[model samples]
Target: MGELAVRIEGLTHRYPEQNADQRALDAVDIRVRAGIITGLAGPDGAGKTTLMRIMAGLLKPTMGEVEVVGLAPIRDANALHLKVGYMPQKFGLYEDLTVMENLVLYADLRGVVGRERTDQFERLLDFTDLHRFTGRLAGKLSGGMKQKLGLACTLVGKPELLLLDEPGVGVDPISRRDLWGMVQSLAEGGMAVVWATAYLDEAERCDSLCLMSDGHVIFSGEPAEQIERMRGRCVHVRDISGNRRHFLRRALGSAQVVDGVIQGDNVRLVLKEGVERLDRALLAKEPDATVEPVEPRLEDAFIDLVGGGPDGRSVLAETTPEVRIGEGVDRKAVISARELTRRFGDFTATDQVSFDVREGEIFGLLGPNGAGKSTTFRMMCGLLRPTSGDAHVMGIDLKRSAGRARQKLGYMAQKFSLYSNLSVEQNLKFFSGIYGLKGQAQDRKIAQMAESFDLGRYARVTAGELPLGFKQRLALACALMHEPPLLFLDEPTSGVDPVTRREFWMHINALVDKGVTVMVTTHFMDEAEYCDRIGLIYRGRMIAAGPPDELKKQAADADTPDPTFEEAFIELIHRDDEARRKTEAAA
Candidate 1:
């Protein structure tokens, strides 16, 4: 191993609360070395963020010995600040400031100047691919671009140790790849990097991983060694008839199935011990079904260690009536956009975009950062007026009758837009009132939502005080309170853990089964498989649209037989970029 950069012994942290079981970290021990990237991996409320905060000297541990580069974090925080660069999950960037202004401000605060500062600034701009956007206001930048700018600002002083908390949370796939590349390069230059994330795939890429669960360190070693424990237990089953949800429900019901998830045209399962193979009779039940053994992933090991399968509860409360499509509803196209276009000043955000979302279908919109997917989504949801053309939601014209069109659909924004200072119960009541609910009806709905979302214990807790997973659940509950026939979710599951993500999809599948149509935007490429179809947008244009399998086939060249969704997405984006470059040259 390289030189030691961070060391912790018997670290413990607890928030002051009325309850005694509120420990955020319990006797955690860790060692981080220079010249490599270390990952802190776990589910929500697993103490990863708390540990990172302690290490960064932002929070003092309740009880522990912590040292960073031989300096005590708490006692010598002032001295350590000069040697460490820390970026919290929510990095504070001045929204009104231009990108260059923010960089300069941070550099000045860190006391960086002269030729050394110029050299560092140039390298950071080049690495983050933000040189062209130096004059753009931070408020106008895309989610991924903002993250890159935050990281650039954090590196102003060229610190020896870097701590990033869920830096790639809402970032797109292409941007996420670029961020990881920059991080690896930083580590190679003898800097120690500690990255906290809920993504197991990312953990597998780290030089070493520390797995946390329930406020304690459960495992610490190489990711491959952890995955090796689940060898021969993972299996892949294909259902070509598009009955993945039905198959998933059945598989999870079985006594031998420990965990199951829908991956592109297939369901990956982790079988219980002594179960060598799935019953062939089950495969014969579904038309064109097949099964095969496959290697285990870090997620598989994580599920096994967690000791529970995906939660099967419906997102809607039990007290709520079952949702049903209106009689004689337009089953062919629940949503339709015809030649939609949107412009700001001289720049076009969306250009001539047209698509149709059928009833009960889960449609996904995918793109890189600043690719105009959000613009198209906003027009369809009646949140923004199109510069030309029209969109119809549930047969209601969005341009002519936006209020009526909005009544037929539920919309969840990219960020958690609920009132942060209000209690969870209060937020539900507030939304209920906004949706025209009243008196007994509002009270009943609030009670049902609290029960369904498992928020009863924290009903009085402020929405902002909840963990990331619970925050997502609360947002979803508010969106579904009115039970509209159609739902619009914009990056709903970003920054969520694998288990919580599975549970979220389970609820979505349940809703789809009950005849609800969903249109969503997400950066997680694997989530594209859950949608019946996907549309890829690039530079204010719809470049491609098709089912996941069809898109994968189109992306595969002579060398690759079958590319993963992420690989396919990258390939398509690169092709579009190359085409645009050629057009500009010809012009």
Candidate 2:
């Protein structure tokens, strides 16, 4: 460690209307060293954002001391601003400005000029891989591209300390890797980095990890140490019994099972301490069910430490319906894209993309930033007219009868698109009305949704005032108010905690079980396992499409019999990139 970059002691914060128990942050002590990355990991409402805001001088702590770069945050906020770079969860980049223009404006605002400014611009553009899209409007860029641009703007002056709040929340894995690489390089050059994230895997990369819960730091130290603490306590149960969900539900109810999650075809469980023996008698009831001790992951340890018993069970409104695959090539398609293509001037957003989503299927569109997934989604949802080609939803032509097609489908945009000024209940009512719900029907639907999504507490709260997790739930509720048979979810779980994500998926599974067809786009590779089929889009084309297990096998070789979904996704993208490079070289 070079030097102490940040120091906090007895840090506590509370909102004005909050009750005595509702402190955003409790008495917390933390020290961040220069030239290292400190990760803040926690569930929703854990106060990670609160601490970051206080460090950035955007908010004042009710009690406690905060020192950033040896300057008191409250007393020397103006000076502190000069030596620190803070990127909030939602980075404020002007939508109309081009990528280069945004960088220049931020540089000007930060007083970066001369040769240093020129060098920094080149470095940022290169590091973020945004050099190719310098002239593209910020609004025209994909979600991941916008994140990179935001990061580039924040790096204008190369401040000694960087505070990044969920910087990779909605970013693709490749872009996330690039962003992390850039941050690590910055830290190696003696800058202190504090990263708050919902992704536990990202926390494992940090030099130090701080796990927070209920506004308190329950654990803080090396990530490896945390994992070590849960060693021998984690176990993997192979479900040869053919009823994984039932087994999971039963296991969760048992006192021995701490937490259980579906991982591929098996159930990974964290058992309570001192329950070392596998219950053979219990296994005898379910033929061929076997349990084996396994290495604990960061998520397993976090869940165990936080005592998240049967966490997210409330989101499981009902049992998921069985997904039937390989019916036939002649099966009727719920969503179909035939030679879909869209272009803007010289740039092609999507090109000749053709795919079919079967009825009652959970279809996933996977890709990196700027790979045209959103453009394709918009075309299918009837939000945008494809420059050529055709799209159909529920057998209705999107190009010829978009209105009729839209009526049969529910669509959720990547960002929170509900009315910010309206209360949660009001927003739900508005959406219900838009979907043609009336009088008692709309009222009943709204009440049901409020309960289903656990939004009853925030019914009267403004949509903008709710937390990110609640906002996500409200947006989903709004989309589903009319109970459309087909649904489109774009980055639905982005920036949400693991528990919230699990809850969201449970709801999706329940809806799918009721014969609702779903089309979703996401950057999180793990989510692909839940989908019946996934299409990998890259550079304006559909490069690959298959079941998650088949896709993983395609990316694997003899040496790697079972490759992770993430590894498969990256491999496919890389292979496509290499092939494109070869074609360009030949040209």
Candidate 3:
């Protein structure tokens, strides 16, 4: 094999306050080939970031040696900085600096002075597609654009090794695709890239994979190889009983199945030892039920390796909804929008978007970047004043009674920001006080939330110091402290590990069951299924609004093509493109 770009031997790291042997990374060993994207996948607290920091020379391993670019990260950080680009999970970019200004600052920091600055800045902006918005403040860019800028700044000195920690988290769909495209292009040009992400779908796209959990590599190889490991074990079973979900989950809880998740009206069961009797009973209960074997995916493998914990029961069954478009919307929606539009000078962010989020149901708002979904979401949340049209949260008009609307709504922003200097508990207290909660009531709420999110121990830790996944949970907890009637989650699970995302959704679904309305925007297509209704936004308009299956059916049209939501999205975009082309031709 060619000389390894990254080599770690007996790597172990732990905090002093942690248990003596509570190692974040346990005696781990790994070697990364140059010029390939190696994805690091694991759940919250699994030590993905710790390993990345070690590789980047930011953190000192408790024990072991790391050779990055033929030198140790600790002893050679200055020298290594010239050859390595490290983007931490949270790369705090200066919000006040314009995109171009931030890029120039980085270039200058890397010693790109005078005549060379112009060309380098232009090239970086062009590659990152930030050229058009060079004047936009770095803080003002969308989640995806900020990420791209972060990557661009990291590339200032032409680093040979690039370590990206969950780079695509919280980005929109099209923007995520664009970021991946850029990453692959960089890899093709001979840059060794280490991308850490919780999304297994994204991990499958990596050149190779290193599955890390508990700070250890459980599996490392092509994703296909990992899939092959669990071949013929995963089966998709349609559960006819409405109670099938509860039953399957309880059964799976006792380890009566290999693994199980709700997948669109079916229980995907992994047959394991001791679950034979239960499996037989399930088959007998639903004789006509379809149980076809499925090819294993990375997600299945992750669940398997992670071991079905108590939270496994909380794992979302990827169930296809039974209701048609608007059929199951019984409760009057808590939030409604009608032809909402927002503009900045000459740029129209949202044209005319209308949708309703049913009370006590999970609703999804999905779209590509620049499609005005965020604008629509902001209007609903009363964060921005709509230029025209009307929006309401629990019957309170957004423009007329923003404070009243805010009282009924809890919003988890795309970017998780709590007071960096404040401890987790302190941050929760601040949010509680904002909602006018006091003393015993606030203490009770914080205790319950801490237990649910498992944030009890970290209550004293600084909010900024929490891991990416925990940061998300803490932000979510802060949003839910008031227990509003409705919640607006903007890409809450974006860039989170599958396990962590699963855990996050579990609490959300639980609250919904207790009559909480949810409006969520996410790039993960699979997540769209969890919604009772979904609205597809494009070009500042609601192009399609319906349940997931109905939208898929409509996108399929009379041809009866086998089109998934993703396929439907592509077809819709294509149709839009064609319509524009025809209009231009007519003109």
Count backbone clashes in candidate 1: 0
lDDT tens per residue, model 3, 482-570: 76768899988877777677677666665665567789999887777667678888778777778776777777976647575666776
lDDT by residue (180-208, candidate 1, tens digit) is 99999999999999999998888989999
Cα error, residue 444 of model 2, in Å, equals 2.4
Supply the TM-score for candidate 2.
Answer: 0.92
Which parts of model 2 have CA positions greater than 4 angstroms off? 239-250, 277-286, 289-292, 309-332, 558-561
Model 1 bad stretches (over 4 Å): 240-242, 281-284, 311-322
**Model number with the top TM-score:** 1
Residue 452 lDDT in model 3? 73
Best by lDDT: 1
Clashing pairs in 2: 321-513
Per-residue lDDT over 11-91 for candidate 2, one digit per residue giving the tens place of the 0 to 100 score = 999999999878999999998998999999999899999999999988989999898998988789888888999999989
For all the candidates, what are their Cα RMSDs to the real structure? 1.7, 3.1, 4.6
| Model 3: ten consecutive residues of lowest lDDT | 315-324
Q: How do all models score by TM-score? A: 0.97, 0.92, 0.87
Model 3 / residue 543 / CA error / Å: 1.1
State the local distance difference test value for candidate 2. 0.85
